[model samples]
Target: MRDHGIGHIVGTILDAPENASVVKELKEHAREAGFKAGYNECLSHVNPFYKSKFTDERSGFHGVDTKALYAAAVDTYNNLSISAIDDIEEFLEAENYVDRLRLLYDYPEEEETASGSKEDAGTSGTKED
Candidate 1:
């Protein structure tokens, strides 16, 4: 189970300080759905691919296994609260789901920043030369 970006993606979601509550929610949902993908050597990529905190041993994994992990991640993201993500339709429509996850990971911060800028600008928000 080599690091085929799944470890990075999952780690990004689960390891973020801002996502502590979100991780709890995800774990609950995963439990309800019988998803053990986050743990167990049979499921988690990190368990098999990562040998240490700073090392990644590439043993390589099957396409089917990779697809299953990706699907689990995609489904988890899709099930996130609306408050966590304003709109997930665009992400669902993307052909490249892996890249979509990367985008989704950054979407919330981008959205918050954009909305904050709008509020700061107020009405007649045109930029002056």
Candidate 2:
């Protein structure tokens, strides 16, 4: 399974300032939700592949351009926060403040498939038992 640790998730959240506010608000909401908002930079080492995919650029690499990548990351973070906050609001019965904090804790799946589906394509005439 892919490493979806907090640092990896939060680093994606912090990749863009537009999404940084979401991270900030999520931290605040987490504090109010009785969870500590811990910070860690360890994700840099957890998934070397993810790090290379998002931040590094090498010739012959077909990853998204940096600007587009950053924008996508922000959009992804916003969507997830939206979903999380919706769940939180339902749990807390705080419909009134849902909109305010919704964007904070939500994070939706990214629009583009990570690294595409090529990695999963099966070899012709190959079968798995």
Candidate 3:
């Protein structure tokens, strides 16, 4: 688990007009970090700005156990700051809801590390991205 709420913070910062500079820096950092896709994927899953693909009736994520994920997101949002943008990939690691699902389903880990972090080495093939 990487902290607990980077993902929620990312969405919050990305939406705040006062954080434009911070968002700019965070976007550049995300690209350099190799977890851009994962961040985008995370946003697509939980960010209201992104309208969350997972919330779509046609999305495969539909009917999945997102209660915990949403609750965590809400809790995270309640206590976020601009400074939390660092180590954004940890957002995915925040709740591990998706990771847990993948693990439970026996999804094989891809050799390529999405975030170039040892912790995320097994996070490929999530398909949600």
Candidate 4:
């Protein structure tokens, strides 16, 4: 049996931010921005961010779970940072929140080694120059 439970994993994520506060803040900002759907999408990223802390090798028999979570995280990031937020002003307002969420989720720099260091991380996703 696994020593760690889902509750423990969830706790680690929620520990950084009171879960209710996160929801309240995101809902208020996203709802006012006329992107309630984005709120749901943004909030959904937390699961994978936390879960990605566990690697496939560490996951034992449930390695697929780790892979799935990581994939979900990447997909969510791409969606939000690329497609979800369209307007520059609206996207700018929400990007900070999403960035915090990514940090809180413990985004894996090691896993993103192909990007060559976190500082070098670049994407044409949502921001406009």
Name the candidate, 1 or 4, with the larger TM-score value. 1
Candidate 2's C-alpha lDDT?
0.41
Residue-level lDDT tens digits of model 2 in 37-116: 11112334445756443332332322424344445555565675543334444644543432333244443432335756
Summarize candidate 1's per-residue lDDT along 1-129 as a digit string, tens digits: 122334654566556554665566556554533433333344354546666542223233322254455557557666665422333345545565434655655423223364455222232312234
Write one digit per residue (lDDT tens) for candidate 3, span 6-118: 44445655776546654454454444343434444675757665643443454444444444544454455555565434434443455655565344334455343586654
Candidates 1 and 2 compared: the better one by lDDT is 1
Better of 3 and 4 by TM-score: 4
Clashing pairs in 4: none
Candidate 4: tens digits of C-alpha lDDT, residues 61-83:
22233334444544543444322
Please give the range of 10 consecutive residues that has the lowest summed lDDT in model 2.
33-42
Q: Give per-model TM-scores.
A: 0.23, 0.23, 0.20, 0.21
Q: Which 10 successive residues of model 3 have the least lDDT summed?
A: 1-10
Superposing all C-alpha atoms, what RMSD in Å does each candidate have to the true structure?
A: 17.8, 23.6, 23.0, 23.5
Worst 10 residues of 4 by lDDT: 80-89
CA lDDT of every candidate: 0.45, 0.41, 0.47, 0.41
What TM-score does prediction 3 earn? 0.20
lDDT of 4: 0.41
